[model samples]
Target: MTMAENGTDTAAPQEGEQQQIQMQILAQYIRDMSFENIVAQKGLHGGEVTPEIQVQIGLDARKRPVENQYEVILKFNIESKNKDSEDKMFLMEIEYGGIFHVAGVPEDQLHPFLLIECPRHLFPYVRRIVADATHDGGFPQLNLEPVDFVQLYRQQAAAQQQAAAQSAQA
Candidate 1:
């Protein structure tokens, strides 16, 4: 029988024989960040200008094939607007990234590990960055609440499954 039917490749390294499966963080950094005080002066006075602050968070990951590494990026967007009007007070966006040297982790679990755990590890720093950026922008220090990445991941998975089921039914 040919090697194709036997599920063995003679031409390259096998997945089973790959090196030790350990995940290590090689580096962490701020990939990009932006803070804009739309009304720089109007929002500077600090007594009681109530603004509704809305924050959005997102996560992404990719493989660095050259070094068998993975990069996880956490995105945070915080926007503040006047409580009664539609005027924007301040908007801040921060993209935090970490380069992880990953080995020995199974392909089945890799996605979750990267999306959930990696960002969970990097969130505090990103949160501080957001706070600092806002404080420097003439606003009160913005403190972010803890993020539940596992819950977010579960929601995404459920949404995907629901979409697939709908399409299949149609």
Candidate 2:
């Protein structure tokens, strides 16, 4: 059978091989969420304020108590500011989680799989929530661009590696 670069077998399994990789989203929920309309809070009425938005993402994954179950949490921190004055316009924070039942993936690749694949499944929901929150906060709806999970994973991994190397040298 062919093996994929991510360490999963591509072709069908031969006799006596393990079952195919399986992943299912058993449950998904917004664990915590908050939206702040800083413009209103600060009473900042402006003249043709241009917005600059920053979005930050974090991911965490842990194995659940039950076998083959895992919990993945995707965290978002979004802030918008006036491009000229740099005054904060709005802030949105959310923690979205999913309970996944996964099987047949090798342990070596499970971490990347969870952090990358699971977030893709939950990003649409997170995007919608952010848009709704901004709209309800008296601002125009903010539609987030699609995330590049693979690139994010690679960048995070590189950062961690750099930190580890620096610490080791110290």
Candidate 3:
């Protein structure tokens, strides 16, 4: 096996090989964003505040009118609350989207490719936005842990399969 120019492993070509897969990000942008500081709104002050944060993620993808183009969106919902009082500290919701031009990916693999790889490319920007939102909201900067896209994709696939089976039985 040898590494292709794109840094992916490829077997030495002895026969006519399929075209190499190609992908390019055409654009990335924040579709929507909101941040609210509940503590500030409530006029709370003066205490050692320990925060517990929850992060929820959702993904969506759709084919664009343009050929070989798809739009993928990653949605994030984050909430922080005081550990002791359980009062809400802040809330943030952001939807980040990317337009990708992808070609040569087999039809069966395209779904996973958009859901996993595209989001991975967009995550760092999302992280930075989250950190800034929290810090600028007058709280300690919140750095999100890295997400495991592969595991997430597998779980979603399993759930879909289970739902289909249940529906068929019903």
Candidate 4:
């Protein structure tokens, strides 16, 4: 077997062939996780409780080629304010993430696996943690509904494409 000039075996990966991919959860961690109940007590005692809740969510993904793994992080911040008092009644923040190892997958499949599959796999555990933390913080259990990551991914992709198209047209 002769090595290519780049020192990699040229014959290893064949074109148009379906590679046997192996995916595993190498490690899952809340790398920089934080849950803050900014107005837990206030919400319970404050008069004119506001039913309005503001929620902000952010997502990020990073790949570690050396470990052949990817890390996907989801961050959320929620705030509830009293409409009358104009003061915050409840605040909750969660930063959760997961690590996945994917190998031998086709290039076309990698994005979906990371953006959709990995997050779907990790959501349950993250939801559990968030619920427990909120309950322990003197709030009702935050029973977050399951999220459809695939739909979310597709929506995001479509929005990006639309934006790009608009920009090009402009």
Candidate 4's C-alpha runs over 4 A off are 1-17, 40-56, 81-87
Q: Which is the better candidate, 1 or 2, if ranked by TM-score?
A: 2
Off by over 4 Å in 3: 1-16
- Ranking 1 against 3 by TM-score, winner: 3
Tens digit of lDDT per residue, candidate 1, span 37-73?
Answer: 9886564444456789999888889998866689999
Name the candidate that leads on TM-score. 2
TM, every model: 0.77, 0.89, 0.87, 0.72
Off by over 4 Å in 2: 1-13, 16-18
How would the candidate models be sorted by TM-score, starting from the highest?
2, 3, 1, 4
Those runs of model 1 whose alpha carbons end farther than 4 Å from true positions after fitting are 1-21, 41-47, 163-170
Q: Please write out the lDDT profile of model 3 over residues 28-139, one tens digit for every residue.
A: 9999999999888999994888889999998899999999999999999999989999999899999999999999899999999999999999999999999998999888
lDDT of 2 at 154: 94
lDDT of 3 at 142: 91
Every candidate's lDDT:
0.84, 0.93, 0.93, 0.74
Between which residue pairs do clashes occur in model 4?
none
Question: Which candidate, 2 or 3, has the higher TM-score?
Answer: 2
RMSD of 4: 7.2
